[model samples]
Each structure stands twice: as structure tokens, then as C-alpha cells.
Target: MSMSLRRRSGHGARLGAAGLLTFAALAGTGAAHADVAAPRALPAGCSGTSPITCHYAVAPGNYDVTVSLGGAASAGQTEMWVEARRLMLPATRTAAGSVATYSFTVNVRQPEGQPTGQGGTGNPGLNIRFTGSNPQVSAVSVKPAPQPLVAYLAGDSTVCDQPSAPYTGWGQVITTAVRPGAVIANYADSGESSGSFLSNAALFPALLSKIRANDPVFIQLGHNDKQTSASAYRNNLDTMISRVRAKGGVPVLVTPPVRRLFDGNRLTPTALHVNGVGVNLPAEMRAVGTAQRVPVIDLTAKSKALVESLGTSASAQLFLRSSVDGVTDNTHFSQYGATRIGELLLQGIREQRLSLAAYLR
Candidate 1:
């Protein structure tokens, strides 16, 4: 199969092996089957109600999937995933009696090592969840393609996909900036560091097992690693880089984004002090990148520049405010801030001319 794939828009008709799969609403009928083709109605379980999750069983391979929404004048958002791995799609909003479409390519790999039966054995699939008011899913389509160049994100909460509104992560918004052929698999989670991510039983192992040769793994740690010794932190990064390289993967080091700690007019180090160690973590990441010969995305400096340029009162907009999360947090970002950071990362990828750039939309 050719690695190249094209996205088509419009209503209903199926195209080819790689065409649209229209879904019908559940009519209080029987259950939905796995192998059912296009123009099939949604199962009895999935309805037009807000905040409903639907699953589909698909053959294990790489696919370019597109989801379309219709009905209602209200706005809504939907998220798609291949099991735990998230697929990037724009927030869907439609006018009264109009339709909205969002599309992205994803690699659906069979479970390696342990068969958790998350998506069932041998047969892998996609999961879609609708959020917001009056959300309704109209259709979904999938086309087979050659293995995609996957860019996997491994880091902390700042890089993970935020589940709800008011809080968002750069990883979640990056899909919109990425070109069609490449897919991003965000494995980052809240409160994760280099050490914890590798030891977290499922995270690192799952990423390593599915990652193919030439896949790029973007790693950003250091927020939670502050508790860990500098030596230990560097070693953990080294080990991760080595492991990724051993698998024929490319490891790109990303310094953690800066916290919104300000000293009067100037940005200051984050107030997260432990054991009297308040060194600049980005410097450490830079040193590791130099030593390991891996490309580095200096998100720390870029975020700091952005914050400093915005000044104190104005910079607050970039972070989670007390009004939204009930607490002022400089460590995490708001949706606007997350989108900016994601754009910065995408710029870095392009500037570096990484192989993944070829797939950028």
C-alpha cells in the first residue's frame, strides 16, 4: 500500500477501500457488529445525546479516519482515540442545520506482548467521545494506508491531552498543526517524570512496543523530576534515548515549558523547591541533548520569552486561572496557551527539518 493518502469531503457515498463509513443512529434495535461496512447505523448503545462514547472494532493496520457531525445549531467537541492513544481532530462546531467535518490519520497497531483485550484480540479499533451541548455524530470513514510516520509524545501533564475544557495540553492541539500523513501518539500524563514514566508499568512499555523504526519520540520531562537528583534525571533521559535508538527510533529532547513564576517584572525560576536544588532544568536538558546528539526543542526558553513578553497581569491569561480551576496554576496552560506552545513545537520540528516534517500539513 502507498504511504500517501488523501482526505475527501462531502456527504455520504463511499469512495474505495479508503472511503467514508456513514453511521446511523440507534433505533432501540440490536447491538452493532464489528465487521459492518459503510452506511451502517450506529449501535443501539450510541445516541445523539451529549457526552456519549462509541467504539468500533477494526482490523489491525494504519488508517486515515475522518469524522463528520451534523444536526443542531449548538456547538460541541468530539475526541477520538485508538484505545488509550489519542488522535488529533479539531473541535467540531456546526451552525443550525449545517454540517462540520474533522479528519486525521492514525496508526492502529495490534496489541504487542500482553493481550489486554482493550480493543479485543487481533482486532484493533477506534473510540470516539462527544462532549458539549447537543452533540451528534453523523459519519466516520477509514482508508487503509502504509505505515505512517508516528511522532510519539512522552512527558508530563503539560504535554498530555486535557480531557475537558478550561484546561488543555499542547499535545492535544498539535494535531491541527500536523500535516495529514503523520500521526501523533501522546503518551504523556499528569505528574509524570522521566523516572516515573519509564517505571509506570504501562506507559513506556506500551510506547516502546508499538513504536516502529524511524518513529520520532519527543521527550520532555523535569517538572516532577525536580524531586529527583540531577544525576538521576539526566541518567533517566539517557536511558530513554538509548532505548529509543536501539529500537531504530529517533529521540528528540524537549526541555520542559517554563512555569509562570515572576519576580516583579522579570520571570523567575519556578517556586517548586525541594532539597535546596533550584537549578535551571532546561540547561540540564540542553546538556543531555548535546551529549546524546539528539535534536532539542527549547520549549523552556520559548515559553519564558512568551511569558516575559506578555508581562505579569497579561501573562495570567496563558495559565489556568483561579476563576476556572479554583486555583491559580502557572505550571499548566489554558487552551490558548496550550495552542501557542503546540505551535512552537511544530515550528521547531519544521526548523529542524526532521523526517516527520515531510508529513506536516
Candidate 2:
């Protein structure tokens, strides 16, 4: 089953395949054959004037999606989302009156409206978003995609996918590093500690329920866990590991990324001082991984090393900064920085020789 819509300045409405066939012929392409649904146009409500998002109903399965952009000007970009998660697409640019096509394979889970405990924002389905001046989408095609191994990321803001520009997380950028046949579902959120994540009704349970056997759940915490006792934080990690294991999922521990805190000429330690003693959060994470016998990604050490190598002025470019906000945040990452950190995470995955490495691009 398929439906299409067209968005114009003052009008928009659902269209049938006949309209899509006309569009295909206009683009000098033949009609779609069996097994390939005709391309769908954006609903009229999705005006081309501003950034518009449109949703399409889809079954709970993997799909290969192809988006054809027509009428693009000098430069433009598009971001595609399956449900709430972003799918990585290569950058595309076109000249006046030209067309550019991008493709990706995504695993679509049941929409949030379903009985799944992973409910959050928006209906469960496919979402297409176009951003930029004169952004135009000519056609969108989705077909059943091959089932691929999945990986889940659970942590704090540092690992989550930030919604807008100037604010990016490693999770969003890491998708580019993941080769075909593997998908990443980042469940990380801001202000979430190890305990809060497990306790959150929508986050961890949703991940646990969907994870299949042998799939890896990458767990990272410590930034917010600093508020709690070291032992308690470790306990939370252990609990998460055990629960994932109970579901036949592989649990991989990841120490949180280092904060860009510089003290004079050296990087500051991420140790929290409690009761006259300093508790090293990353060390605690490593200890927990050892005790639980789970492979740990020592991102703390890796990130700190990266920052020290870049120095103060240069490394500052990695964090969130804006003249308007007048706030320099060391905890979060800008797009460039997030991409670098994402690469580092990829390196860790490769270093450990995790099964997921087979899917790295």
C-alpha cells in the first residue's frame, strides 16, 4: 500500500500512484515495477517555504529508502528520520534545475502509538524533512530492507543525537562510520545518569524489549552519575548489564567522554571529590566493567588524550559555542567535534574487535 502528497505555496493534498507516475515520466524515468512502490510526494501542508516534516505509515521491518530531490538550487541538504531516529545520508549538492538522489537502509520499529514501552514523541513511521532555501523533494521510495544487526547506545547528552545545529552528539555522527548491515539506535538523553536511564519508563525498557540475541548494547554514564555515590553508580551499571544479558543481548560498557576542562597547561581530572576523597568516575567505570566481565570502551582516556593534544584554543572549537548564547559549554559537542568523537568511538569498537566492527564503513 502507498500514498503520496504534494506541497505547494497555497495548496497540498494526498496523491495516488498515477500522479507519481506522471512525476516519474517528467523526470525521464519509467514507472516502478512490482515490489517497488511508486514514489510519494510530500503533503500540501508540508510547504516548501520553511523546513517541513512529513510522516508516512510503515510496518515494523527494515526498508531501503531512496529520496530524489529535484529543483534544487546551488546547494542544499536533507535529513531523513525513521520514526524519531535519524538515518545517515551522504551529502548531496546540485546545480539549478538538476536532481540528486540519496539512499539508505533503515530498520523501522513499531510506531510509538503501538503497545511498545518505548513510546516517546511523534507517531511511529517514516519521516522526511527538507531544510534550506528552495528545498524540493521530487520523490521518495521505500521497500523492504534486509534485516541487519542492531546496536543500541544508552548514556547521557554527550552520546545522544542533538536535534539542531551547533549542538551535536557522538551518537548522531557515528552512523556514518557504521557500514551497511548494521544500525544504531541511540537511546541516550540529556541530564540522564546511569540510574535515571534505567529507571526512566521510556528509555531502557524500550531498548531491552527490541534488542535481539547477540546484539550489543553500548552503555556509558558518569557525567550525571557523579551526583551519586561511586558504589551506587557502579551498581547501576551492573544492573543494566545484567538486564541486557537476561534479554540475550551483549552488554558493552563505555566510560563517559571527558569534559573539556583545562587546568593551566594540563587537562583536569574528571574525579568527583566526596567525603574528603576523590572518586575517579572513569576508573570506577573500568572497575565495574572488570567485575562484570564486559568489554569496556575507555573513552575517557581517549578523549582526554585528544583534548590535550589539541590544546586550549584549538579544542574549544569542539564544544558548543555561540555569540548569541554567550555560553561556552565544555560538556556538549559541536558538529565537527561530535564527528571526531564519533570516530574515536568507532576506533574503540574496532580495537575491541567487537562483532559490530564487521559493519563499520
Candidate 3:
């Protein structure tokens, strides 16, 4: 069985594979070959019949994707490319690859939607490690990673899906209260992870290209980074920071937001368990900041402090006021939440004394 879903754009209708797709599942299944719309979809410029197939689109931002392979898509190796959403990937797929699982990442690009940047890991919508026995797109567990200020939240649905939902992450809100020129490019996808986000082919590259000499790229990971350790969030963070610094962008680290966990009526940050450790990351963050010589925001600490002040009951007030989507979401933010976190980031910038502080009001 196969499944395919196209997230329709607000202004566009359902787009067919502008070319042809040889409907094959990602499992490298040796089953009969036939184009199945469920698992395979193609975009412009792809031959649609070759071993290296591409699904390109001109849209920007993040996306969640599932890729499967049928007989032909499986027997022969395959190379994939998601055109508009940036990052880096092999120009083609090989027969040695597994096809059972779906690939998810936050695709990024230039304002006009073109690929730009050093295609590395943590890009959305452009990767999957197909070990022969690995089941398709299965995430046994997920946790947050060491996050920093100036979050570049990039993933599928887990990203800024709504102005109100921070269960995904709160980069948007974290960016707002800062001075007007500060950059908070929330490119995270709701369903993306370190493995896939790095391979998206467009977005990551664009992010790299977009880096200015003084830009600080804060990463709020773990929500998805923990889902796939093969891509190792810590290592990725280390590498991403190096890249950002190499490109002249300051790299701040952040820990994932704590879950809405309460302990016998007390709001506890310890509930977001990671190897018996929680995600409230001030210690780890402070070290990373000192080691990397970049400022750390410690939003997790501040948020935890705020929760402590609000108490377990009032803690709910930090989230967005829901409409039909339910109210008081914790994982994400509302305008109010985003605003608060954004202010925290601005404060972090000031404390760090980055020359860029002049940009923050």
C-alpha cells in the first residue's frame, strides 16, 4: 500500500506532477512497476522515467515529504532533488538506497525560490537513510536539541504552522519583539528532522547564502532533531554553528522548550525527559555560548522561570488563545507568547554585547 499527500497552497489549486512519475515506493520494492500517485509525484524538468527522478517546485518555505519506491524506482538506484526548497542532495538517487520511508525537511530558497547555499545536514525535505531493513519513515521517539537564540526553525508542520501554535516551536515569536532589523527566519517544518532538513536541496542552501557578516542563526531543535539521531543533533549543531561562523553569521545555541509537565501541582521543566535529563538547557547552553564565543538566550530557562512565576495553573496563559484549534497551546506561541520570547532574545543579544546590539531596540 502507498500514500501521497500534497499540502495545497492558499492561493493555488492541486498541482499534478508537471511531468511524469513512475510511481515507485521508496522501499526499493521489487514489486510490479506502475505509476502510483500515492507515493510518487514529480515536478518540472525531471525526465520522470530515469533512475534519477526529481520533484521540483517553485514555492519557498518548508515542506514535509514522503518518498516510496515500486519495482523500477526500487531495482535501479535513484537520486532525488526538491527544486525550490533549498539544501544539498546528490544530483541523483542510486539503487543502493532504500525507498520504504518518506523524506521530510523544511525546504528553503531565495525570495524567488531558487537553490542557494552549501547543502549540508539539517535542511528539511531532502534526506532519508535507507538501511535495507529500516522501516519507512518510522520515528520511535523524538526530543528537543540544544537550541540557541535567533532560531531558524526549519521543518515541516512542526515549524510555524500557525501564528498561535508553538508546540511546534516558538522561533517566530522569539523574533518579533527584537529590533526591526534582527533576523529570525523560521524555516522549520512540522515533520522535519536533522537528517532530512540537511538534504532539502534548496532551503538550507538559501539560508547559507542569506547569511550576512553579523547575522546570528539561533537553532531551536530537538522537537525534530531527536526524532533521528542518525543525523545526530549535537554534531549537526556543532557543524551548523561552524558553517554559520565561517560564513560570518553568529551561531547561538538553544535548548528545546520544556513540555507542559506538572509535578504534583508544580510546573516542572524536568518533564521533557532526554536520557533522564530535561530540555531546560541553561548549563549546556552557557557552555556552548562560552566555547563558541556566541551569546545564548536560554529561553528554556526564562520560559521555565516564567512558568514558575505563573505557577502550574497560570502557566497556560503563555500560549496562544486558541480558536477551534483549542486554547492555550504550550508547545507553540500566540502573538503574546511569540512577543515574550522575542523580547527575551533581544535581551540575550544585549547581554552578549554583540556589536549587532545596536540593531535591537
Candidate 4:
């Protein structure tokens, strides 16, 4: 199902796919197609769709999106995602006969969203998708944002927006923990290391082109850097920092989060991200942060404390277990685990007093 819209002034005035997406343009693009709505009951552009997708064709840049949720006929719950699967809003419930309005910034680019480094990823234009038990999108307003801060994420699968549900990354949900005015554009991909991410033309090079003045580029790796030497890892990080600085972007280092590996109540060294070559990866990240004068979010230490405090049985909820996600994965995070890690990242932002901290929700 699809519809078209007429471009407006300002943003829409710019060249190529730039415009506001009203209710008329919202459609269902998911597996379950939408039920065509009655004129009076649903908004003109919206369909009574479980997974309603609204796409705004616009020039690559940041956009301010406002969504009015809930229905007059029945109570509803909704989860909003943009670009790829970056969770913009967590599941929210609204009562019947009421509308809850929400606004957030989104960074739109050509590849559309983060490519997982694996094939078959990304969508075209500024895509806003809604899904949940009952998703009621009454109205939507998309406008070009003027110079909002953009937080770019770079790392591996644990930090990338997993193309599928149930398996998520912290970067995908971090936007939910932040206030408006700041948008997160995750470039992290699966099986990426510091070395590979920097050298990849489609990843780091693309990120550098988008860096605005004072933009914060958060780098987290080590999950796939198992064989990288300490000196090489540091060098990769230093090069990234230097390039970001040249572009007037502030580079922040982030150690990888710990795996849910436990040994009798304490996390094993491997769980703590000690590489195959006997390098303490997180410690090395901290050292680089110090030498480069960059703020480092010690996610390894923070996640270690949380995992250890929760212990074996409880901490299992922090990762994808076989029963939950149909796969026993110790490294990747489940939705709950991803949210928890996102919270830890928020805490780190506040602790380090990074400029992005000022926008934390």
C-alpha cells in the first residue's frame, strides 16, 4: 500500500525527495498488510495497520519527527523505529480516546541506515515504522532539523542495529534514553574490528563525511578484535580519533561490553574481553582514551559489575539464550539486555560529562 505527498517550503524546497509526510502518505509495508481505513475513523494518510510504515523522501540530513499515537475507538500500544531497526521509542501504552504525542530527531542517509556488513540491509528514504500489540498512528509530522547534534556509533554486531528483532544492540536503543535535539546514527556492523571499521570505505569514511562541528563519534570494538595486537588496536583508534578531530568532531572511545561468561560467581578473563593474544582489551581502550585525551566509556567495567552482581542465573537474562532467542549466544544482547546496556552507556555519558550527556533523558 502506498500514497504520495506534495513538497512544502524550506526543507522540501531543497533538491531531491525532500518533503513532509502527512497522514496520507503512511502505509503498511510489513508482512501483514494494512486494512484500508474509514475516512472519519483514521487519519487521511494513515491505515489501520499493525505495522504501519511511513516514508518521507528527503535529502540526506537530520529530520525532526513528530508522531501522534493512540486511537479514539480502542486503547493501543506502540513501538517506533526509524531507518533500519534503530528503536526510537520503546513500547508505550496509550488509553482509548487519547493521543500521546512524541518527537525525536533522525539522521537520514543514502544507504538509509547502518549496513550490517552482511548483505541485504537498509531501506530507502526516511522510513518510520510502528509495531506492537496495537499500533495507532493518528498523525505524523516530519521536518528538517536545523543543526541538531548527531552521535555516530562505530563498532561490531553487539553495537550495530541487528536487522532482525529479539536480537538488538545497545546503539539501536540508546536514542530512547536521550532527550530530543540529539540523534544517533549507528554505523556499527557485524564482525567489525577497530582496524576494519577505519579502513572500510563504506563505514568510517562515510561517517567522516557526515561529521558536523562538535559532533560526537562513539567508537566501541574488541568483540571481533580478538587477534589484533595492543599496539595495532591503539593505532587504529588513534587514527580514527585524529581524522574525527580533523573534521571537528569529538571522538569518544568505548570499551566493548562483557560477555555473559561466568566462573563460579566471578566473570572469567575471557568474559572480561581479554583477547586471544592475552591483551586486556578494555584496559587498552582506557589507555588510548587517556593518551588521546578522549572520553572513554568503560562499558566493560560497568557491564562486568552488573553481570557479576546479577550472577550466573540472573545475568543470563542479559544475553541471548537458546530458550529466549532460539540461539544460545553469550556475546550478543537481547532486548532487555540491550536496554540495560544503553542505560549503562547513558550513565557513562553523564559520568564523563560528554556534551551528549546534556541531552540525556
- In candidate 4, clashing pairs total 4
Candidate 4 lDDT over residue span 1-361, tens digit each: 0011111211111112322121212222111222333222444444548788777777878888877776446667788888768777667666666666667788787665455336354655788888988888877988898889999999888888787877888888777655458888888888888898998888999889989899999999899988999999999999999999999999999999999887899999999989999999899999999988999999999999999999999898879888878998889999879878877787788778999976654
What is the Cα-based lDDT of residue 337 in candidate 3? 50
Pairs with steric clashes in candidate 2: 5-42, 12-44, 111-124, 179-361
Best by lDDT: 4
Q: What is the Cα-based lDDT of residue 146 in candidate 3?
A: 20
Q: Give the alpha carbon lDDT tens digit for every residue of 1-361 in model 3.
A: 0112121121211223421111232223222223422334332323324333333433444344444543233333433333322211212232422333223233334432212222223333222222222112112111121221233444333234232222423443332122222334555554444555566655555467767676666665555544434225555556677888888877766555555678866555453524233332345445666776766666667666666667776666556446524665556554445444544555565676765454332
**Across residues 1-361, which tens digit of lDDT does each residue of candidate 2 receive?**
0111121221222334322111122222212212222233564334454465666677766666666665433334444344443535423333445555545556565432122222244556666566544455666777776767889889777777565556677886666445446777777777787888898876788788888889899998778866677778788888999999998899999887777877885776652212123667778888888988999999888888888889988888878776633568888887668767776787788789998876654
The true-structure Cα RMSD of candidate 4 reads: 9.2
Per-residue lDDT of model 1, residues 115-203, tens digit only: 22322233346555665445556666767756778898888788876555566678866665444568877777777778989887667
When sorted by TM-score, best at the front, the candidate numbers are 4, 2, 1, 3
Once fitted onto the true fold, the runs of candidate 2 whose alpha carbons sit more than 4 angstroms away are: 1-54, 59-62, 69-87, 94-101, 107-120, 132-138, 144-146, 271-277, 324-326
Worst 10 residues of 3 by lDDT: 1-10
Scored by lDDT, model 4 comes in at 0.77
Error of 1 at 128 (Å): 1.7
How close to the true structure is residue 102 of candidate 4, measured as C-alpha lDDT?
69
| Total clashing pairs for each candidate | 5, 4, 72, 4
Give each prediction's root-mean-square deviation over alpha carbons.
9.1, 10.5, 17.4, 9.2
Among these predicted structures, which one has the highest TM-score?
Answer: 4
TM-scores for every candidate against the unseen true structure: 0.74, 0.75, 0.50, 0.86
Location of the lowest summed lDDT over 10 successive residues in candidate 1: 20-29
